[model samples]
Target chain A: MAKGPNVNWLPVKDDNRPVNLDLTKFHFPLPAITSILHRISGVLIFVGTAVLMWLLAESLSSEEGFQRVGEWLQSPIVKFIVWGILSGLLYHLIAGLRHLLMDAGIGETLEGGRRGAVLIIVFSVISILIAGVWVW
Target chain B: MVSRVSGATNLGRNGLHDWVLQRFSAIVLAIYTLGLLGWFAVNPDFSYGAWRGLFDATWMKIATLAAIIALCAHAWIGMWTIATDYLTSLALGKAATFVRLLFQAGCVILIFTYLVWGVQILWGL
Candidate 1:
């Protein structure tokens, strides 16, 4: 009988263990943090799309409709919403591009992924700032 | 049963397909977003007439439609993936899958409505 570690032939079973991970105490890596933020930004953009579609539909209806949207956008609250949505969009866009590049065999390594995450954060901040200035 | 296992594996394959389509749609959306933003940035005097004229071009209308479709596709896959990852039997038990399916259905309805609305707007009907 072969009694070596490499020679043991045991059937692997499905891991049905209960997950007890304490998310609050868990320390996520930078890349993981970026990934979670990407999901969140996606949700934000999803919700914001309704508001944008409404604005678009209204603006395209008539000249008065367009004026109404333009005036509404001038309000501080509306401007704030626009800024928030644009910020979410900008972050999501950058992170999404990172994911695409990863799929294309770029940033496939651990160090490369980390660098990409950092670049996404930096680019998103600058873009959001520009969007804020444009909206305000 | 072996058939059941194969069925589950097929679902996994479909997920891979969804992943590919999601990225493809994302690329389309990114291009459209950049172009639209650039147009707005250069045209400081954005009025109703300017907005109308921009969409008045056939190419612009087609591009906008394509972007709208891609946006819907991307959002559907994204939201579906999120729901599947977070909302599961381990989390919400029996209610989890039901809620996830409901949310997905709602997204589908919303996407369909947006597509119809987009077509109407683009064709000026």
Candidate 2:
């Protein structure tokens, strides 16, 4: 890692808190980054809801409408979008479950929270990739 | 430990509600998605009457209705929590809440209405 001159990475203690200067002063920590991603996933789900609903409506309308939707879905572009939506759904589900588990008094501690956040990302990526395989 | 009891209780209640529905809806959606894809694969030229007939099965109608309702509610609760977390302004959060409630209500009504209409179609009403 390249650091500019006069950069002092020190383990400074504040009050009784252990300050890992590399983590605190340099950049956002893993847990904070995952927390932000959780919010982003939620927003993605909100937007994807409209697309899924539109597809459902079209499919259920009539035979022609069904065919139309099917044909539209057959296109590679639409298929990719469908895959993207499903991936988003899978990721959101994993992240949401992580939050739920945290709420259940499971991972509120600093170390526990960090581990859980990493697990959320790992699970989300795996589930989303599985969904992508099924969709695409 | 003692002071956190109340907060823990609240968290458990809310998280359990969302978690249970999310799992329940995912199960239904998994079945529904497979069924839909299979139907399309088997019958390429699926017609209106055929479509009606497919949905005419009592269990199929009920299952699909259940899926739609669960999906809507699960999505609603999930999205609501997300909105509340992100939107700091009280007015914006309230407005978002109102809109989410309306959307959820509309989704339920639409699904139930469609189910009833399908029943009518099956019964020649």
Instruction: Give the count of colliding residue pairs in each prediction.
Output: 0, 0
Off by over 4 Å in 1: A1-19, B1-13
What are the candidates' individual DockQ scores? 0.44, 0.11
The CA lDDT at B3 in model 1 is 27
Against the hidden reference, what TM-scores do the models get? 0.87, 0.53
CAPRI-style class, candidate 2? incorrect
True contacts kept of each: 0.56, 0.16
Local accuracy of candidate 1 as per-residue lDDT tens digits, A1-136: 3222221112343434443444666789989999999999999988898888888889988999999998998999999998999999999999998888898999899899899989998999999999999998
Let me know the TM-score candidate 2 reaches against the reference structure. Answer: 0.53
lDDT of each: 0.82, 0.62
A1-136 per-residue lDDT for model 2 (tens digits): 3432321222342344343434336677888888777666655755665676677566666677778887897789998988877776666666666766776788889999889888988887887776666655
Worst 10 residues of 2 chain A by lDDT: A4-13
**Which lDDT value does model 1 have at B96?**
61
DockQ of 2: 0.11
lDDT of 1 at A73: 85
